[model samples]
Target: MAIKYIPYFKDAIQGQALLDNFVRTKRILKYADNNEVKERIERGLPLYETEVTEIVGKESDNLVIRGECISACAYLKENNIKVDLVYIDPPFASGADYAKTVYIRRNPRIEETIKKAEEKLEIEDLKTFEEKMYGDIWNKEAYLNWMYENLMAIKSIMSEIASIYVHLDWHICHYVKILMDEIFGEDNFKNEIIWHYSWGSRIETQWNKKHDTLYMYSKSEKFYFNANEVLEERIISEKTKNRLKYKGAMITDRNKGRGDQEKALPTDVWYIATINGMAMEKVDYSTQKPEALLERIIKASSNKNMIVADFFGGSGVTAKVANDLGRKFIHCDIGINSIETTRDRLKETGASFKIMDIKDGVNLYRNPIQTMDKIKSLIPGLKNEDSVSEFWEGAINDSKLGLVPVYVPNLMDSSTKLLDIVLINKVINLAIPELPDEIKKVIIYYIDIIDKKEINDFIKENLGREIEIELRDLKEILSETVVDDVLEYRILNNEIVIDSFVSDRIIRKINEYNEKMKAQFIVKGGKTKFIEISEEGLELIEMVSLDCTSDKGIWHSDEEIKINKLGYTIENGIKTKKFWDGKIKFLKRPLRIKIRNISGDEIIFNVI
Candidate 1:
């Protein structure tokens, strides 16, 4: 097949060589059922039902969907949520793991005082932990596929007169331009806006590349654009200023009136400063775009009260600017930190918005409801309906696995051992009693790679029972892995109690590395070491904020709580144990709690 357009690299694979690679990976469709999405959106049915969590305002009826952009876009399509404008600042394919620095304050103190004191603290003054926010590492083919699927999904939900602005650097903008052309049609192609900013890193080998490209595309030929609203006045011409007086009026250009000058629209090239470290709008997140940049896009493409959206909501500048410009916005992102940062930023704007999770990060493949059936098929002589029913009962109530415990039956044979048995059978629909007498050794296995200790404990608790049980992990068997990372907490008498937490995913990684390498990692040393992870997971947990009574996504009064193995308090030049084991007290009820992890992933849930 003849290639249409491909960005050639020096000494890189070219033509069919590159096309072959692209063709190898099957295209990923939007995660949402397109027909279902369309039906729901057109019918005005609620696409999301998870009690719209308002991150920071007095009940925003507006939406903030979290997950993959394709999922959010699919949901938007289902709800017929027509977006007047879409701005995406997706990964530029920059080969770097952009991380956000998280700080833990020393000395246990009151939440109110901590928030106030934190405002005055600098990045260097506080003890810090670095957590990866998002990874921008992608090969050409993977990056193209990722962008293509999202663009197609975004196109389905756009209004007839909607416009899209894709903010990207030089790295992948050209390729994405081709992708957008195929999606939006070449005729609808608009300007390749140059957002020039200073303070970019200077390199010796090449001239400073200090500008980002924003490719604007419309859904149709005639789209909404307000040039007059986004215009920049031209500076007075030297010729007009240096003109000699003729009679009553100066011998200058007759079109030099103040109002006329103001009518001059800004060019496609815009000069906006990058968000500095000390900027009030800066949320300490890397790759954060400036408000001025989004302000121009929001004002030019969308009108007041119109719906705007940003799928790749890095730092939430688009949502904040759109909300401030009197436009409703829908912000979607895969990163937990992105959601948390944007939610907090929008809270300051006091924009009422609902937070929805399309994909459960905590329950990915680990969902007990979905995985239990598949697990039953893997075990030998345990395909009975009663066994499957029993598994579900234990899983729903289990403290550690949170999965239906496998049902292991005692063997009838003398030499049959439970530990030596392999769970490798497909379903034959035969009853458990119909199985051969030699296969009576039924061993229930929990395939976990990280929760060895937790698995061992479960085994010990069930030992000396009629049925034999064995703990199996990913290392031992090829069965599916489940991560039961949950926070066990309770609220009674207006006080919050954190009983325990299971961060199995992080612990598993630590254990895996510890066995492979001789060097001892801090996390491998046990639970005493602070649990922190890259991207979004349990380790990202930093602080939990509880608002006593909040239905809207706003936190009125919050008790900031942190978990530490050892914490101290200082009073009158004497340090005392304020918290025995990161013990926190909350004098509130019907609480709305937002738990922010190290990587900025937050879960805002209520305990009423």
Candidate 2:
């Protein structure tokens, strides 16, 4: 009997263009909404508005983008760039929150604050902390849907003769396999590779899951796979040599009857060591894969200069190995840390690429409190935090007057509004009149700018009582304030220069975190000292690496250099920790540099 996989809720996948495209494309058939589906497929998927931030190498060599994977794929498709090979190592849905341990330098300015505390302070106190990287906790349904959308986007940009390797663990591999089968067709399913390692925890009652599944599938039967490129050499034993001559004449004797060796192409099982603490390739990322593993997949499925992509580009091992193997790549990840780490890794290899970010202002809209606070700053006499309410038409503290709300649509589309006529009528006729006469003043805040005459007509037509209305325009306030600082760089002679370092930003952010920490301490009634950095904050730089040329195999000059806050250099196989002069200089032309701070925060930039 033939075997088949059925995902948890396969029937629920309807009207989603991504899932439909897989079946529609393979069978040359149409779904129910064929027109919309065809139009979407033809026009390519739409992505968040993105702007290119930096370009390190040549414009065509590689791309490192910071955005969600599905959006990144849409961006790729819109540009007419198709990839021949894709290897994604998405979150394994282990329900564990992964974090990175960062060591922050004990600021000298905090020494006095520590001593003034009620608790005795020690000079040897540790300042290291943990920060959550990404959340892998997801219910099965949400995970499947998220993966389905991304996989669909990925599939749309794949060349007809391409291969995709989806890396997953035992937790959700079975479900994902069924998803792939539904999307890519069962006949095209190729291998279920087992990548075994030996290091994690072992349960007393259950067998240790030391292996991960890598699902390899081709877009079509004509997909490329070069076996010779990834073949492993095996030594011929005497027994095998004797068996080789079983016909008494030897089968054409390519080895001159010696049977000395044979090339053993890799099977579905791959045994590669996980990155250890001391491994040269280790970059301290929690989910970093081994370079050897990526190398084999890249070589076997792709050729030099062909486009290779990894959407869940955690640790950037896929791109690093692809660059080393002489392939153009497009790496995408949503995390700022992932983007920074990948940029640095690519720069260390001297690979030229562009960094882009989604330009849509959705993040601003999502934070209502911060958005409201910013709006409050622009309006006079609205400084009282007690008077502000996040919801519309809410009573103020001990006051009969309540706050009213209005909104313009998104900046991109101003015709929309949060409070339509019906909702406005409810607030004016129902909520406003019920308030006591003492609440004569109604503070009206507009989330965005709109025509004032329309607002006046609405207020005049609806209100029955004499109420003083104050209006504040959030759009005007946002326009006057700077949104974000865009970073750029250039290489002059043997030196790299940038617009500005992140030192001040780092200090400001640390201060903000410290303020929150202080709030927690106050609630707990515990003694804690506030952290602060000194004027010479550049002393926080822990390490810097540079790739002067577009060669992945060699770094221009990884010479031993010293940095403050405990920096180390490796020479020959020994590691020496020292504080040396922190002067970094590199040859110009296609330069990439990665600068890391003591707190493990890093930035990767390219100088054109």
- Please report the candidate that would top lDDT against the real structure: 2
Over 4 Å off, model 1: 1-59, 109-122, 236-263, 360-542, 547-588, 591-594, 601-608
| RMSD of each predicted structure | 15.8, 12.3
Question: Taking the tens digit of each residue's C-alpha lDDT, what string does model 2 give over 93-193?
Answer: 88987776555543323454334432444434535445567667666654665576567678778898999999999898987887788677889999999
User: Poorest 10 consecutive residues of model 1 by lDDT?
Assistant: 1-10
lDDT of each: 0.55, 0.61
TM-score of decoy 2: 0.60
Query: Mind giving the per-residue lDDT tens digits that candidate 1 earns over 1-608?
Result: 00111111123222221222344422532222232222222322122323354444556647776666655765666555788899998888988767666554443324453454435445455445454555576667546655665676687788889999998998989878866766677789989988777878789998999889999999997799988676554434564443322112222234434443423545676767777867868777788888877887888888999999898887888888988999999888766667767766675556777788753222322122223333444443233433344312122223443223344321111011112211121111222233333332333443212234554554455333233344443223223454334666766565666555445544554454445443344446543333233322322345667676665654553555543312233221223545323344565564566655443334566665
Error of 1 at 34 (Å): 20
Residue 285 CA error for candidate 2 (Å)?
Answer: 1.1
Question: Where does candidate 2 clash, by residue pair?
Answer: 57-352
